[model samples]
Target: MEQDVSAFLGRLAREVRPRSNQWAGLLMQRMRGELPELWEDEDLARVALSETVDHVTAFLDGLEHNRDVTRAELPPAALELARRFAEGGVPISTLLRAYRLGHVTLLELLQEEAARLTDDRQLTNDAILRLIATAFAYVDHGSEQVVTAYQEVRGRRMQRRLFLANEASRRIGTTLDTARTARELAEVGVDHFADLVTVDLLESLLRDGGPQPPTDAPLLRRIAQRSALDGSPDSPVGTGRSHTYPAESAPAEALATGRPTLLRVTTPDAPAPSTPDAPAPPAPPGPPDFGIHSVLLLPLHARGATLGLAQFARDRTASPFDDEDLLLAQEIAARAAVYIDNARRYTHEHTTALTLQRSLLPQGPVDQFAVETASRYLPSGSRAGVGGDWYDVISLSGARVALVVGDVVGRGLHAAATMGRLRTAVRAFADLDLMPDELLTHLDDVVIRLQKEEAREGAEISATCLYAVYDPATRLCSLASAGHVPPTVATPSAGSRAVDLPDLPIGPPLGLGGLPFETAQWELPEGSLLALHTDGLIQDRARDVGASLTLLSDTLAHASRSAMTPDEACERLLTRLLPERRVDDVALLVARTRALDPSHVATLHLPSDPAAVSGARRFTTETLTAWGLDELSFATELMVSELVTNAIRYGKPPVHLRLIFESTLTCEVFDTNSTAPHLRRARTFDEGGRGLLLVAQLAERWGTRHGREGKVIWAEQALAQPHLP
Candidate 1:
């Protein structure tokens, strides 16, 4: 071996001499940019390239004397580079082959330069063989130690990846909230497995009641991001804060195809391609100045559907990810995907329950005569407990109205369904003209029965309710509660005050219905504001109920001082009282009191006699005429005469006729009797039974409203649109 090497060295001692730039240029020209890890760091590549040229020039220069480089004579910079390549875990074969390309180029430069310098074919050929031999000797001597270091580095990295995978498995899928789950994924990946991590979800899946995105391509929104690069955007779009990934890009393709991928790095100068399915995403605040070079995008999937994707990115300074790293990343993504899918299912159910509740709620006032009303309902910020509160307005017999507000004890679809049932029962009881206290007792009974009928074995049905009945003429309000929050009354004289009935004990909440519910009477004067609400509007886990109610009262008082409409009052109250993030549903109703003007109302008392019927007719006609509702007086007078005559014949004493002129003309006759007059169609031959029938036909609507004093038989006529001069 020594003699053959000496002979080869003797041939090169005469002719092989390479210039620095000549060989370096040749080496670079021969390379096709295929180096993965080394090419990533341009500074390192430049340093390595320059050192290689120097080492070759110096070694060839040394070979003229001794023809070989021992361990002592080896270039320090080249030896240091070999150690770096090993520590960096570069494939020994690729590195050796890259160096061989440089060797081939340097040898070619030596042959060409030598021949150009002197045209001796024998010497040039001899120098070419000698330089070729020198190339083989250099590679053999240099890489002998690097290959061992590289294998050691590769083995250590494998162990580190296994440790990382175990660490990630224990950390991910611990939470069922989708955003939190995504955040966990990003947090675990950053600084450990990758330099930057991002988790993006399909846009449609984030919305309530949103439909499924198209299978071809779906838009994504970044939910969580973490970055190791300084001031670099965690996402591919927007500011360094967070944003969506570009369409037709790595992350989007991963999600759209439900596939994992290692994305190709995009150059800043390349025009981004656009497709119909994947429209290009917006450019970010910074230029495409991201440090990310290697990206691993793994789709987050469970139940055969893609929830989103987890992206792990490494900067140019980091090593390129291999197949094993990609596998570990995919495992982490799979674990987090389970929790995300669970959260999505919970969201879908919560939305459906809320939708069902909203669909069941009464939109606006059904009873326009009693009050000018407005209402607001707000769901929890988390949207988990949406269906527990409700409000309603029901029109009663004498243009009186019933206002209702209630809340079920628990939440979800069952609570919403129960709220609907209780609301329906309130309306039914309101139609019967039941007193507020009586109505609550019946509602309590209904709820008890509902629980028994539904047989919710483990779950019990219970709720709180506020029922109020208002009489416009009397300007009286009778309110009753089933362990509910007392209402606040904001009158012109008194800014706002809770109608706290000191002596009135609130009955047990519905479902525990043995005790009788008591009614508290307070005259809510004309133009007064009544605010009724559920506990959610006033109370939260962090606040005291009394303190919340006090705040609510002050809020309403402030709103009332502004002379706001009922709707405006509700909005103002909500703005002030509702917390930034509410944990429960809120139901609120604000009604302004309305009363009939004395001038619009006329009344006459009468003894038990047939002649009083004519007097009742005269009173109705004159009252309608004076109010400019004379067109309706003919029908009103006829209905009144029939009602009064019926009361006289049925033998009730101290009867009275009352007339009210408003949007509609109404005539009411009060009798000492408790019997309610029923309307029936009389047979064609029966003239005797047609008086009540004639009253029903003449009046647009008629009904009896029972009062503590007596039963009121009232008839109504829709007034003419225009009044004649």
Candidate 2:
């Protein structure tokens, strides 16, 4: 039976040779009509079906009579069809189903040809059995080959995706800009993953504190969008465009459910019937040629919250987005979301710290009676953030001014708080009329105490300060440094010089130990400039401190020193020396020296006898008359009598009295006693206590200033503008 069947198959091959082309065409027609996926891809489907039919017909034509099995080897074309399916992101199940359906068509044709040739049941049955055996053998071989090709191509595609994942992980999130991070997410998709990309962030996240919209209609603002198409990048709804999603919108659903979505975008010119279940169409995405076919909306979820959604789109020229592409888009969005959240948190903190620093600083133009001054304070860049640089102009007794510039050890709120504590202490100490060196000595104690407290909490503290006292009476500037840079002093006679100050005997920085601090006194003349600043004004990591100081001196020397007010000098110095963005905090205070003219002063040396009180009062009354201050003489005489009597009767010897005529009438009595006077209520029975009490009431301000040898009891009465003759 096998021999007869083989002979019959060989006869059948010869007889069917004329009509083999017709049989293959018929099979192709059948598959196209039945399989819709194959028909949609007309080019690949026609080529693949044509090749399969040609091979099947050739196998029958080449059948042998003596062979036990008919040979029908799988064609290389079958492997190519598998590759094409994989490239189009089509499933392999359809490829196998098509081959099975084609096998049935081939078998049906074999039976019909056999019946037309012989009309004998036995011969037809044997031909059918041999044909079925050979067909199954071919189908099995081709199916195996196609699967191998499919998997090989699929593997390469997955490898490429892996490379892209690594590329996105390495490139995105390199900066702290939240918008840049979103733009980078869009950038990653263009030309590589999709033809067009857009990133939509939660509007609530970008807006300052506010209540959110409903869950189904949460707002999303498109932060970034890019396109490979020539005109698509100019799309209006990108990079800061906002849109409110309807209840069934894709973005809303994806965010509300915390899941990624793959969807079909409606065509540009398509008409829509009103369907309540339909998602509202998003705003027009600009140019009509953008041709969006498929969209993948992936939620950017991190830290238990959905930050935003990333949308990737492909035009009609490319295949629709698939599950694998959606997965990749989600992965990329996930990476960028983490970086944006971090940037958002940092921005919140930085803004809060900046606000706190500004509030803690001094405000308004500060005018001490003895000096007119101006100052500038600049904060560092975002990288360095906020630091503790502060300056103050403090008014002291005897027409002295305390110029303070200090820098705390760190940045942010903690450093600013430390600066506040030190500034408060400096002002309190200045009121006591301590010398420059003594004020810093007391400030060092406060710093050490603060450091101890900070250290117990596992934090270290250190600081540098320049404290200077300028006495208009003597035209002297007393300066002390706690590891601070020397201030710049400019004069018409001397030119500009960075004062070479000696370091305090104390350890460097304020918090180290109790050490003796050295005070340097410069006999600054009228029109002299004393520039006190934090080290940030003169020091940076890239430049040498000496070089910076020399540059500062030269800049000041070359500037028009005589014409410059403290404000002009400060503005010019900063414009010439500092860049737009500073790396460290800067605090600069400039004071132009104004000495008390000799003509405005009247001095008298008195014998310490009890009779010197009347002479002191007479001297004050005559001096006030000569300076055209007669209107102030009554109050002035009363203050002089009380102060000089106290200085001679109970105070030390070598008493001298002086009256100064400037903005106010100043009367001072000097003695060798260092004890500060106390104001007290005079009892009904008390006699002499009322003298000091009466002085306090007659003078606008009264205070005691102690020198090394003695103390001066001074009173200032507001002057009436003189009637010039």
Top candidate on lDDT is 2
How far is 139's C-alpha from truth in model 1 (Å)?
24
Alpha-carbon lDDT, every model: 0.73, 0.76
lDDT of 2 by residue, 459-516 (tens): 7788888888887878888888888877887776764554444443423678887677
TM-score of 1: 0.67
Q: After superposition, how far is residue 432 of candidate 2 from its true place, in Å?
A: 2.6
Task: Work out how many backbone clashes candidate 2 has.
Answer: 0
Model 2 worst lDDT run, 10 consecutive residues: 269-278
lDDT of 2: 0.76
lDDT of 1 by residue, 570-660 (tens): 8888887888888788999999889967776788998899987788788777777787776776777778878889888884777888876
lDDT of 1: 0.73
Q: State the lDDT at 117 in candidate 1.
A: 55
TM-score, per-candidate, Cα-based:
0.67, 0.80
For model 2 the local lDDT of residue 399 reads: 61
